[model samples]
Target: MEARLPYDDYPVVFLPPYESPPAWVPPHERLYHPDYNNELTQFLPRTVVLKKPPGAQLGFNIRGGKASQLGIFISKVIPDSDAHRAGLQEGDQVLSVNDVDFQDIEHSKAVEILKTAREITMRVRYFPYNYQRQKERTVH
Candidate 1:
């Protein structure tokens, strides 16, 4: 039989079989916080929506939807664009798109609905905050 060293007298050491500490982790596609993408402020839409599909990788969730309201809003309607021609105004709070309430839907699901909708009828609360309409603001 092999002899065993005394617990107190043995030399304290980490075995070589163990892996070394990680220096850096490889970057991967991942959700930053709150929602899946990085900046919510950048992606924040006046309209919110929910959607589901069997082939979809992510489960049902909410995402930025088509603009419901139009000016000095969190979501801006591009000038002379489809959204702009649709009578959508800035600072409009989107209650729903295609009559679907999107208060708490997930991001992935929202994308699906927006993509699939043929004729979207968005219900909006316009200019509740009294923000002035302006040209598109640029992020510096």
Candidate 2:
């Protein structure tokens, strides 16, 4: 037999212990408080940025075929790191490092590029799957 459980509609927002949302208000409509926003930093997972000098090389890894099952593969950048400062985001596909094509290079060679280059020029493909849905329109 299929069992049913009760569902309580709770607000996703952070609330103080002494404060409670109004009964008539739905959780989704709650406003974000600046203090609550600051507190959220403590709960969510975060990445560390690797530090780099004025001009430093960047790197990434890719597995599977050139198409499917491809992930960022490697995360060498740290939070607040130099690469992050240069506008490098996580999950970015590293197409080229130092203007060198990475289509068929060995893994070790990729690492060497990051270690030696004074400045990194990576041609990255940001989001492959989700962005492909740009042409579709949906109802909220």
Q: Rate the local accuracy (lDDT) of all candidates.
A: 0.45, 0.46
Those runs of model 2 whose alpha carbons end farther than 4 Å from true positions after fitting are 1-76, 128-140
lDDT of 2: 0.46
For model 2, residues 1-140, the per-residue Cα lDDT tens digits are: 99665566554686435756435544454455332322433333233334435455443333322233232223334566556565555444556665676554555666676666655666655543422232122110
Clash pairs for candidate 2: 48-78, 48-79, 49-78, 49-79, 49-81, 50-78, 50-81
Cα deviation at 114, candidate 1, in Å, is: 1.4
Best by lDDT: 2
lDDT of 1 by residue, 9-63 (tens): 9888874365676344334634443334444453244443333253432211221
| Model 2, C-alpha of 3: deviation from truth (Å) | 48
TM-score of each: 0.37, 0.41
Model 1 root mean square deviation, Cα atoms: 19.0
| The 10-residue segment with the lowest total lDDT in model 2 | 131-140
Q: Which is the leading candidate under TM-score?
A: 2
